[model samples]
Target: MITANPAPEAGTEARTGSSPVRAVTRRKKRQWLPYLLLLPVVVAELLIHIIPMLIGVGMSFLELTQFYIRNWTAAPAAGVGNYRFVLQFDEASGKALLHSFWTTVQFTVIVLALSWLLAMAAAIWTQHAFRGRGLVRTVFLVPYALPVFASVITWSFMLQRDNGMVNHVLVDQLGVTDERPFWLIGDNSFWALIVVEVWRLWPFAFLALTAGMSSIPAEQYEAAAIDGAGVLRSVRWVTLPNLRSVNQVLLLVLFLWTFNEFTVPYTFFGKSAPEQADLISMHIYQNSFVTWNFGTGSAMSVLLLLFLLAVTAVYLLLTRKKDVDA
Candidate 1:
């Protein structure tokens, strides 16, 4: 005999039956809400970051007017021609382009070296407690903390050749009596510009590395000493190894930051920046804004971004391998 529907359990079957639909509806709602929330962020990024990047890349391959929009009637498919002109220093493109590229390379390397070295040294030296540690740390950071343009202006004032404080101290007060050296006048004033970058950046590196050094165990050093290691030896063996990751990250970050820093060098030297200290960002600025060659500026931006990406990739590869090996 067919059993009549078993006497319905109180609130059990109905609850169980509805639970699936409720769960599915909840799941669907949760899924849709996230995408909806994400929509604005994604769209914002696309409009601000992604769109500009795509436009830059597109502009790199096309000839264009001073305004940057490709002149449809006269525009040519330049392919890699623009890049070749910049990189290969095509005589047809003129000496200015080659000077820009070489100077950029020089500036990048010098800034990277000086900033990292001084910062690491300062970080290590300051690891030992002394009076004024906090004050000194604040002092070191002040350069980077200052507004870029303001700092540049201040530095320019300090380095001025004629009535400049630097010249007065060196020539009249210090009794050097040498002709005053122009800080921003000559094409070889790499020194002036380099001082600005290193001064601004070392504090950042110092902050990162000093904190890393502090976290390292004191016992490790004591152990190393017990094993007959000197201070330098212990550092090479223990400190450097521990610091590798931080060093790697800081180096990469400074590399990118220094490479892209525009305001300091530009404000200090403008278009007359020493061939040795001019950088990619300045090149782009001059091409896009000074000359209003937006198309070429956009192209330069694309190349600079690609260069930065390559650097980032190298950093990732090196750090990943180190982690794996460890």
Candidate 2:
């Protein structure tokens, strides 16, 4: 008691005052750490993708051609001229662009329908347990596993009109045609492109569907069986309902990928593609590189991008409605 009110413990007072402040500081640092780590990725994405896209958009609004190719900055501004020219079908060039776009749409629709069907069938078939199931699954994935370039090149060789395995079997063995049809030229090129694309894309759909199938509860199928539901009915009522979300996403992805497809057609048909198989991608390529009309090519690309965005928005809205109804 003689300690003159016993000096307030200085150390304890300091600890109590600073603890809250220290905690708040640590939390702020922790929160900011993830953003700091992601800074590099954001910057890389901007530099690689966004910047080029902006540049292309800018180029679309300018008259960039071989005439001004040396110095693109000095190219005259075209404003909406390029877009108008592309959209108007009265002109010969515009007609060609429209035709190419229609061809692409047809190809995308056909490929998407066939690929999705085959993949779904394969996925459902492989879901059931059986001897050699693992082997079958692996075999199903081989087309997707192989390098696209090598596989496409091999297909190109095999599709040759003169001395190719496809024609060999059709003509020599089966006597389907007296003369070897030109698979890489004229209208048949479209069919050849579709066949090759279906082969490559179905495997991807198979993989996606298989993954989706794995998450489906086994009890659902069991209940269906107990209710005396057959395999087809079970699929229609149970399996499809469960796989709806997956299929929605898968269909959208396939549509976008197939619509923008370039490599398969390009590799199959080099600098020159037949009118029947001249996809929008190759059309843009020819406009930009072969014809040296960068401005028109950029405009076409921008239009295609906008169209795809609209399609995606509509698809999502429709799918969301279906999900809500379900």
Top lDDT model: 2
Off by over 4 Å in 1: 1-37, 67-88, 92-95, 270-276
| lDDT by residue (tens digit), candidate 1, 1-326 | 11235454544333224578776566556757768989999999999989978766876777765633545445667787766655555563446666766777788788889888898788877888899988888888888789888888888898888877888998889978678777776653777888888888888888999988999999999999999999789879988999987787788778878778787887887555565666767767766666665556666777778878887887788787878998
State the lDDT of candidate 2 residue by residue for 89-203, as single tens digits.
Answer: 9988899999999999999999999999999998889998899999998998898898888889899999988889999999999999899999999899999999999999999
Worst 10 residues of 1 by lDDT: 1-10
Off by over 4 Å in 2: 1-27
Give model 1's clash tally: 0
The global Cα lDDT (0 to 1) of model 1 is: 0.76
All candidates: CA RMSD in angstroms? 11.2, 11.3
Clashing pairs in 2: none
**TM-score, structure 2 vs. true:** 0.90
lDDT of 1 at 197: 80
Task: Return the lDDT, model 1, position 105.
Answer: 73
